[model samples]
Target: MGRIAVIGAGMGAMAAAARLAVAGHRVVVYERAATYGGAVRRFERDGFTFDTGPGLLPLPAVYRDLFVKTGKEPLEACVELVQVDPSSRHVFAEGTEVDLPNASRAGVVTALDEALGAGAGARWGDFLVRAREAWDRTRRPLLEEPLWPNWSVLAEREPYPSVPHKKLLRTRRATTLAEVGAWELRDPRLTALLESHALAHGLDPRVAPASAAVLPYMEHAFGTWYVRGGIRELARAVYERCVARRVEFVFGAEVTGIVEKDGRATGVELADGEVADADFVVAGVAPGALDTLVPGTALRGGDEIAPQRGAPSRLTVLLALRGGRPEGVAHRTVVHAADRTEELDRLFGERPGFSSSPTVTVSRPDDPALAPGAEHEAVTLSVTVPSGLSVSEADVEGVLGVAERAIPGLRDRLLWHEVRTPADFAEETAADGGAVPAPALAAADGGLLHASNTTRMPGLFVVGGWAHPGGGLPHAGMSGALVSGLIVEGPQFRGSQ
Candidate 1:
């Protein structure tokens, strides 16, 4: 049995540790923070609980598979996973509102048509059909398997099969997400609805590849899910599963360096200067932090995809309301921006800053555990913003204003509000400028692809959001599976059967 040392107790790292332990490897996790679950954190005050990251989970099969592979208990037995019907309500700039049903294409199409116009639903349904094509084309290489050596094939080819548009005398296909929205959807509201998926990932739709269509398709196909208490509960279940499998966790023990001998990673150097040797090492950290661990060694080859940086981060506002959450309210609502051009420019512009009226997502869960009783409610408002910005009073106020569209009398009902910014993310995950990583895409000349899971040095591998398949709850879980497969079954291991 090989001894494995994992750096970080994040979701992906913990998932890998649990599987490796079941495979008969002695695995140890070292985390800098006092607890596990890097970005999946919970804040509690006066009986009010809020999930500071990722309110909803998409493609829960990833975790279900994790639990099945590592332990006897299934994921459903460990945590209460509920499918949120009327999955999301969209509040457009022009006051048009639509509540899309969970995992029902026909229902979503009908609702969009009824709210927007006669033909709106048809356009969206057709777009989803095309989006499904994109999802099927890239699903294997992007999520199920390790990033290929000739990943340039994915970069060079656009799998999205965009409809041909005749502009003047020439025929053209949409390359960027913006083009797809404008040419295919052909409605301002529909365009905004499609782009919102891209923006939610901190990506500028105008520049994001057409393959980004998979984002909305994945949610529409698999449905949106919520844990009974908060997303942090999912993290808790995974951590406990790891412990059940004999995976050792050392919290508050920061790994400062990677010990190498004869040009191979042998162990890790903790902040206290103690070295724990292992047969293999897996690093689940941001690209910048990973670089600091191995001072001078170039982790990626010149021809390999470079590590992604400067991605935008999220600004979340947790509101404690005095009123009970009304029955029959949608679990999530997205308030689109008033001006798309200005919002995009400010977020991805030369001088990056907050939008005066930013697109905000308001999540109001109908769980009694989140509040003191039936008398109070906990609401979370999140917006994608440029990374490394200081959160000001006005910024917080603007977010509240955007949220007011979803929750009437938001200011009056607000008992107390807390702002969680990129700064908090930086402290928790060691990501530079608190930049959140987006999932890898199949096009845009490979601009959206992440670094390979395997490093240049033998016996060293990367896992987590910054690695192959990239970010989001499901993708991170898949990364863990891929890394464990590579180590347990040797490098020839392709993916889960």
Candidate 2:
């Protein structure tokens, strides 16, 4: 069996390690942090537990596949996921509330009809059908594969050559979420609501690709879920599974370099001066960090990792409220700006260090595990801000002011708050610039310059949000599985051929 060294213990690292271990390869994971789950981690303060990261889990099947492959059932390990009834509630500046239901094609149309206006539902339905068509067409060909410099491999798998290629190419040029929504929905409110999901990715709606509209379809079709205890529980489950499979975990061990010989990965050198050798190495760290590993030489010789510009990071504030749940609010609430264009102009155009009227997500208050009794409520507020910008004391105060305006009595409700800036995220995750790297093709340059293309590196592979499929827990986990399959299947295919 081939010995493997996996760097980073995020979802990507965990998934890769677990899969390889079960496949009979001896696997060792080196994580910089004391705990697992990289960005999807939880932090506790004053008896209040905050998720501190990703608040929603959509696409349960992806996780189910992981559990099944690892010889365990997801439901048996995790709590039964209760799909958020109204998937999300959008609050406009005019105080109008639009509740999007977790429903089917027709049901979603009806919901949109009721929320937006007459005939708007039909338009939404039509848009969704097209989005679903895109989903069906692209699921296997584009999403499932390792999208690197080679377009021929993806092109050969496309069901319809011309249409898929055009659509895929169009995604590269899209700049904002609003531009994408415009191609589908006519209602302004519906458009805004549809554009909100892009915000989760730290993207502007106005220039985001039309293909992004498929995200809502994926959410509605697969449904959004929350783990009973907390999202971190899912990470813990994966970590335990890795342990059961005898995947050696080395926490607080930061990998500072990737050793190369004859233009191929040999092993890794830790920051603490320990060297671990392996047959293959999968990097679950940031793409920008790769420069520290191998420095400017593409494993594939001609291919390179591109640097994307204009992708923003987030400013997150976790508040430990003094009391129980506030009246008339769901688990998730999005407060839209009174003047969105102006606000976005300041946020994206001026490249503000902070945000105004940012989206806020409040987890379930009934969970006593997170807070003792009902006296305290844990809520998290996340605002998209430009990457590389610092959150000064004034910037933090400014964000607090916006939070007060968005939520009634927000200042009074909070017992205390912990603030995390992009700089903080950068320092915490060790990602270069503290910003999640987007495909340069998807961002400013509209060229495939900035993205971690794993195939470009022979024995060295990358997974998670930094890699081709993009961020989010689902995609991150999927990327891990894909890399594992590549390692496990690569030899078998070669032998067969």
Candidate 3:
């Protein structure tokens, strides 16, 4: 059994370490922060708790699989999941409300037809079927495999490798959702609605792949679920599982360098100059930060390996409000501006900042543990902003103003508010530029967006949001699982070495 060093105490690193430990490897997780769950952590102030990152917990099956692989059941440790009805409530500029239900495709289509117009539901049904096919084709092959630097090995040896490689390259060069939606849906509102969901992943629908339309299909098929407590409870549960697995966790141990010998990583040197030796190293941090840890050798030819840029970071505002629940609003709400297209273009193309109409998601309604009382509510308002926008005190007030307009009685009911900009995310999570990595397939050159596979150094592997399968809690966890599985299979058998 080999000793392994996993960098970053995020969900990916924890999951990888747990799996590696179960495989008989001695695993040590070195985290820069004082706690676990890098981005999935929470903060408390004045008796109110706010999740620092990732508010929603979709794809519970993924977590269940991870727990089961480690001889634990997720439900045994965490609260049962409750599916949110009216999966999402979208408020358009014309005051038209689209309440998406968590139901079958036919039922959803019927709801859309009733909510929108004649024939609209049928078109959505056709679109969903196509999306489902794309999802089915790509889910296992591409998403389950590690985005390795050496593709030739898999192409020549692995099962169904050619299909996945072709699918990824095709997806890399596919048209954006905006273009496809324009062709499929006659109603601009419907088109925007479809594209908006894609944008939630920090991708611009105009440039994101058409396959992203699969997101809706998955949400409806699997149903949008929320943990009984806040999403942070899931992270805490995972952390607990790590402890139970006998995985060594060294918090506040920021990795400064990846020690190398004969061009192979042997261990990691902490920011405080302490060295922890191991046979393998797995990084859960962003690819951009690799240069700091491993220097030039770490990202050698990285630019060519995965030539994609990251998506814009976000300006997320968490509001603790004091008021009764608003009528006509569901657990999740997305308020679109009168000129959403122009607003998005301006946000992404020009100055990156919050718009007049930003997307807002209100969760934890059924779960009273998050708010602590029935009279109080917690709402998270998220907007795609520039990669590194700074938030001043004035920005907080401005955001609250926008939130008030989007949701009635919002400003008057506020108990307090906390604002987190891209800069805040960087400081809190150590993610470079506060960017949430996504698939960088927007370029005509077929490069990915945020997903990178630049690992060239021996004994070193990159996993999680910054690498393949892109960002998203489930995909990041799967990335780690894929890497662990590869490591278990023997690096000599894998071409990534």
Candidate 4:
């Protein structure tokens, strides 16, 4: 077995480390931070705890298989995973509310019908059927398999199977996600629901390809979940698993550069002027950091899809409230912006800020572990904001004004709040412009896809949110699997076994 050098102890890096160590390799992880769990960091103050990144887990099966493959215990045996009932509650403009149940197709349809009115449920359900086709068409190629050599085929092709519509004498098919909402769903509230899914991932719905509909379909299919304490617990479990496999970890050890010899990666240079040599090197840092790691070595593929940079990130407000979470409150509630057009324009356009009425996702997990007792509650409000801009108290106040709809008298129930912004993300994950990476989206000539795990450099590879398959928890987990498979199986490796 050979030695491997893993950079940044993020989820992806750790996932790969555990697997490679179990495969009889000496894997050492170097994290710049003093502790593990990169962006999956947790916050604790006044006996209240909150997850600063990725509050919920989707498509957990990816992690499940990982634990089973590497050890005798499954993921559930290590971490407390609880399914979030009423997957989400959407509070749309025009005072419409819909509570979509956990992984129940009929329940979602019924909820939509009750909230959006007659035929709305059937329409949304039918749209999901089409979205299912898109999921099936791209799942194997996009998620399960590595970025193929003929990746341009996925770029040039749109696998959404959009429904055709007739406007006047001409016939057209929905090409963009916005078109899918306006032409197919055809309701203002439903449009908001559909667009919100894309917006949550920092993708502008107006321009996001119709294939993006798969985003919502994924949530509806897999359901949302919460760890008993916080989502960060999942990261802790993975880290422990890596430790159990004897993967060496050196915290606060900043890797300054990759030592290359004869066009192949041979080791990494530490900021302290020390060098750690390895047979293979894996990087989990942002694109900018990756460049700094191994200067003059190009990692971008021939497909022209640069790793997404300066993308929108999240603004999280951790609130400690004076009262307990009431029964029947959904775990998650999306308070839709009153005017989405203006919101999108402000965040993605030249404004370099968020809308006065921005969409806010409020998470109120009923887990007692988060609060000191039943007398108080811990709440988190997340809003998608421009990565390059700075957020102010006024911007957060605007969000709370809308959030009042979900939790009436939110101001009265107020407790002190702590804010986490893109600047914080920059320090935590070294992401460029404080932008958080989204999952690798299909379409647009593969313009949004991430670089392959196996880079042009012979002994260097990329993994984590910044790598192939892209940013969300499950996607990042999958990226680790792909990198490990490639390193272990050699150049002929196609995908995970």
Candidate 5:
């Protein structure tokens, strides 16, 4: 049995630890923080709780598969996974609102048509059909398998089948997500709806590849889910699973460097100057941190995909409200900005800053565990912001203003609110500029692809949001699976069968 030393206790690292332990390897996880679940954190106050990280889970089958492979107990046995119906409600700037049903294409189409106009829903439905084609084309290469050696093939060729649009007496196809919205969806409200998905991932729809259509497609195909307590519960379950598999975790023991001998990673150097010897090293950290650990050794070949950098982060506001969450309210609501162009320009333009009318997502879960009682409610408002921006009071107020559209009298209803800036994210995840990683897409000239899990260094692998398959809850889990597969099965490993 090989001895494995994991550099972080994040979900991806923990996932790998559990699988490796079950495979009879002695795995030791060293986490800088006192707790696990890197970005998936929780906040508690006055009997109220809030998930400071991702509020929803898409493609829960990833976790279910993780549990089934690592142990006999199913994921459902460990946590209450509830499928959120009426998946989301969209409140457009023009005051048009639509409630989309969960995983029901017909329902979503019908609702969009009823709310926007006669033909809007059909346009979106047709777009979804095309998006499905994109998903089917790239699902295996992008998510289920390790990033291929010739990843440029996936990067250079756009998987999304864009409809031909004739303009200026010439035929053209949508290339970017913004083009997809403008050419295919047609309706302004529908365009807003389309781009909102990209915005939620900290992606600039104006520049994100057309292949990013897979983002919304994944949600529509699998459905959106909520853990009864909060997303942090999923982290707890994963950590517990690691312990159950006999994986050892050393909390608050920060790793200082990677010990190398004879040109191979042999162990890790802790902050206390103690070296923990192991046969293999799995680093679940951001690209910048990884470089500091290995020092002068180049982790990737010049021809390999370079590590992605400069991704945008998020600004979240947790609201503890006074009134009971009204029945029939959609669990999630997206409030579109008054000016899409202005918001996009502010967020992704050369000088990134907060938008006065930034697009905001408001999540009001019905779970009682999040609040003191039925008489009170807990809500979270999140918006995409440029990474490392110094936040001010005006920025927070602007976000609250946008959220007012989702919750009437939001200011009055809000008993107290706490803001989490990108700075907080930096401290929590150790990522440069508190930047959040987006899921890897199939196109965009390789701009969206992450670094490969298997690096140039032997006996060393990368996992988590910063590595192959990219970020998001499901992608992180898949990263863990891919790393374990590569380590256990060696160079012949092609991913899970």
Candidate 6:
């Protein structure tokens, strides 16, 4: 059996460790932190708990498959995967609110029409149909399989087939997501709704390709998920599964560098002046961390160009409420900002920083586990703020001001609150500039993705949100699958069939 060493106890790393152990490899995971789960963390105090990362999970099938492939117990048995109904409530700047039903296109369209105005639903529905085309065209290359050697073809060609629209007596086609919103949706609220999906994933609709339609399409098609007792339970479950499969873990073990001999990775050197040799190494971390492990290792693909810089990390606020969470409230509510253009510019343009009225996503789960008693409630507010910038009380106040519209009496109801910024993320996860990797997309001449799972150094593979198929929970899991496939199945390995 090959001795496999995985760095960082992140989802992708652990996912690979579990599958590798199941494949009869002697796997050992070295985590810098005391706990597992990279971005998915839970904060608890006085019986109040809040998910610090990724309030909801989209495309759970990725984890479901991981459980099915590695063990007898299905994902359902490991944790309660609840499908959030009326999936999300969106409150726009114009005071228009729409409660979209989960995985129901007809219902979503109907709700949008009722709230946003006539024809809005039809326009969105049509866009989704077209988004499906993009999803179908790029799914195998983007998610299900490893990037092919001819990835240039995927990069050069845009999968989304934008329809020609006659504007001012001239035929025009959309190249970016913003054009899609303006050309078809034709309404301010509709445009806001469409762009919000992209912003939530740290992508700029103005620059993100039309193929980004797949973002909303994926959510609408598969549905969003929540894990009972917070997402940390998921991390616990995955860690347990790895243990069950005979994988060993050493917490508080930070890897300082990767040892190399004969131009191949031989093992890793720890921060404590110790080295552990292994036959294969799987790294699941931000690009900065990967660079530190291997001093001169450039994570480049076929062209060997410089790696694309990842997007900024998220800013989250954990709120402990004085009153109980009322029933009939949507589990997730998006408080859309009044000025999306300004916000997007600040986030993605030359002026990268905080927004005075940035869009906020508020998650108020009715689950009893989050509070000490029914009389108390726990709430979380998240915004897609820029990474590497210092966030002030004013910035946090800006998020709260928008969120108050959704929460109603949010200021008084907030018994206590704590804000976690990108700086904190850098401390916790070691991502450069606290930048969170955006999910891989099909756009921008290939800036949408990280380097391939396989690196220049033989016996070393990279896996994480910063790697192939890109970020987000599902993408992270898929990265693990790809890495494991390459190691277990050899160079001839294609992705999962």
Total residue pair clashes for candidate 2:
13
Clashes of each: 0, 13, 4, 0, 0, 1
As a whole number from 0 to 100, the lDDT of residue 468 in candidate 4 is 88
Per-residue C-alpha lDDT of model 4 across residues 1-497, encoded as one tens digit per residue: 99999999999999899989989999999999998988999999988999999999999999998898789999999999999999999998888888999999999999898888999999899999999999999898789898888888888788898889999999999989999999999998899999999999999988888999899999988989898899899999999999999999999999999999999999899999999999999999898899888777457655545666668988999999999999999999999998998999998886667798989999999899998889999999999999856888898888888889999978998888999989998899999767888787778778678888877789999999877888899988898888888899988888865
Poorly placed runs, candidate 2 (over 4 Å): 152-177, 299-310, 326-328, 350-352, 359-366, 397-406, 437-457, 491-497
How do these models rank on TM-score, best leading?
A: 1, 5, 4, 6, 3, 2
TM-scores for every predicted model: 0.99, 0.87, 0.89, 0.99, 0.99, 0.98
After TM-score superposition, the amount by which residue 478's alpha carbon in candidate 3 deviates from its true location, in angstroms, is 0.1
State, as a TM-score between 0 and 1, how close model 1 is to the true structure. Answer: 0.99
Off by over 4 Å in 5: none
On residues 135-186, what C-alpha lDDT tens digit does candidate 6 reach at each position? 9998988887877776777776788878898978799889899999998889
TM-score of candidate 3 versus the correct structure, residues matched by position? 0.89
The predicted structure with the larger TM-score, 1 or 4, is 1
lDDT of each: 0.93, 0.69, 0.70, 0.89, 0.92, 0.87
Ten contiguous residues minimizing lDDT sum, candidate 6: 301-310
Worst 10 residues of 1 by lDDT: 294-303
lDDT of 4: 0.89
lDDT of 2 by residue, 444-472 (tens): 22232224435455788877777756677
Q: List CA RMSD, all candidates.
A: 0.8, 4.7, 5.2, 1.0, 0.9, 1.2
Task: List residue ranges in candidate 3 displaced over 4 A.
Answer: 148-174, 300-304, 307-309, 326-329, 392-398, 439-445, 449-454, 491-497
Candidate 1 residue-wise lDDT, 375-483, digit = tens? 8999999999899989899999998998999999989998998889999988888999889999999988889999888888788999999999899999889999999
Cα deviation at 145, candidate 2, in Å, is 2.0
Identify the superior model by lDDT, candidate 1 or candidate 4.
Answer: 1
Model 3 Cα lDDT, one tens digit per residue, 286-388: 7667767876746434434452345678777787888655555577777765677766775687666655555544443555566757777767777777677
